[model samples]
Target: MDFMPIFCDLKEKLCLVVGGGQIASHKAELLSRAQARLTIVAPTFNHRLLELGKNANVSLVQEAFSEHWLTGCWLVIAATDDPVINQSIYHCATQRQIFCNVVDDPLQTSFITPALIDHSPIIIALSTGGNAPTLSGLLRQEIESHLSTASLDPLSTLATLAGSLRQRVKNYFPAVHIKHQFWLKFFTDKMLINAVEHHDTLAINVHIQRLLTESGAVSLNENRSN
Candidate 1:
């Protein structure tokens, strides 16, 4: 089956996982990182899951899985070693129109989770549509080695300012082509890279001003004010 990839915002959303072993613990940890309101259902939990629950502050049910548990979940995972129970969980979640992923059973799952490189506000997910998860994990580690906090955080901050900068451009330049050109040059200019590399907001602003000056589309009113 073909799967189109998407990144979900699980913050404050309910997520239910049916299992408590290592695999389930791993999935729960990832969901917790996204700040999901997580519930783990199993007769017992692995030591790691207990630790994760304490840290992520998630709900733990020391009982068998039940259909009622599917009631309000925005997302579901069935990672149990019991095939019958996992299948049942998948059916219940699917019947409820909720997305569910069954561990090691891609055909039974509605979605597949990918190995991710999260430089939050800039996440890169690698997947082979459940065909090659091992390879994806290897690539994720390889990519992680190349990324640093200093490099990613500054660009993420700059990305936050992009919306306001776009609005300013729209208000200042009425010509569509010139506005597009200005942004193109702004990105290509070495100073924009320097500003981002150095985390220099002031330098970024100066580049924006440079865009207006070089675009040659500044209004006559602005020229008169000058």
Candidate 2:
């Protein structure tokens, strides 16, 4: 992969958007969803952005872009139509060691935003290293459709349960390979699968406890034999 995939924690972090157009607005909205504090600079903003500015987390500045705006920003997006302004923003951000994305111009961007499927606690991201965004977006849509119709528990709910069970599993199976084997069996267990498909929390818990008990007994017997 040309670019490494990673998720950023932008909660309460300062982010700068240097434009007032739809693309800029979209980027700002994504940041706001991550709870980032935003400072948007543009001489004139479209209606959508103006509405977004009403949010307490967003601060809109009606002015031209300036290097001074980069101060304390964890990330910056250059969405202005003017190539000169975008280049300037990129250079300034580079100088300050800040991550910068110049809209659709990947050549000028230090980072590229991927198309995301946010199923909270189970987010999925797709990217083409900024080479083929349309293809990436199409694939994301198809995967999202499949996920919605799949005969499985909600991904977020499943992930949450797995997270809650992690410590218990670790405690039960101290060896890495044993823990891995236990999870593999647990997920594929017919009883657990049926419980998950029906969203039966009580059944799921009981199934887990029964499996743990059986596995623990087997481990103890193996140790006695050894």
Candidate 3:
């Protein structure tokens, strides 16, 4: 817990990446995936970086690093091979209170990137707290292999359904214990799981309605509370 794992909403937020090599490109791609408005400051960029810049919200500053680039940036990544430049970037960013990551140099980083699995609405992040990134990647691969398509479908749908039912859930289950029981059933009920597994939207709706209207369900909730 030395490093607090957190997800950021970098959408449209200004992010500066200093360097243009392969590692820099990889970091830039991750930032792009988060929809960060990225500005890359480097004299040269690798081919992948150029390709990514084509479609991504990325700008290229074909010049040497400048401390002025740190102004107004939400975060920064120092991926340059030159330790001097990377250290300069790290110090400047930290002085400005902007979080920074110096690639391969965790001691200089305010944050570390974790191995991620992007299953659309379902995203999993793995980290070794900047101790072993390779281990995190291996763990992510193993976990990804065990995640079946059926499981992903239900989880994604469950997230969506929860959002759609947010207000209804509050209105229908005013009692805190009753609301907890209702959600507990969403995971434990075999019938609901089967409907989600089969991708039967109609059956899912029927099950949800039954859960709401059935007297037995309310009694079960009361029993759980007691």
lDDT of every model, 2 decimals: 0.86, 0.88, 0.88
- Compute each candidate's TM-score over C-alphas: 0.81, 0.87, 0.87
Sort by TM-score, top down from the best: 3, 2, 1
Per-residue accuracy of model 3 over 156-224 as CA lDDT, tens digit each: 877778778778877887778767777777766789788987889999999988876763468566778
Candidate 2, which segments miss by more than 4 Å at Cα?
Answer: 149-153, 196-199, 218-226
lDDT computed for candidate 1: 0.86
Candidate 2, residue 102: how far the Cα is off, in Å: 1.0
lDDT winner between 1 and 3, please give it: 3
Q: Which residues of candidate 1, in runs, are more than 4 Å off?
A: 55-57, 142-153, 163-183, 212-226
Q: What is the total number of backbone clashes in candidate 1?
A: 0
TM-score of 3: 0.87
**lDDT computed for candidate 2:** 0.88
Best by lDDT: 2
Prediction 2 TM-score vs. true: 0.87
Question: Roughly what TM-score does model 1 have, to 2 decimal places?
Answer: 0.81
Who wins the TM-score comparison?
3
- Consecutive 10-residue window with the lowest summed lDDT within model 3: 212-221
Task: Tell me the tens digit of each residue's lDDT in model 1 across 46-115.
Answer: 9999998786559999999999999889999999999999999999999999999999988899999999
Task: Give the lDDT ranking, best first.
Answer: 2, 3, 1
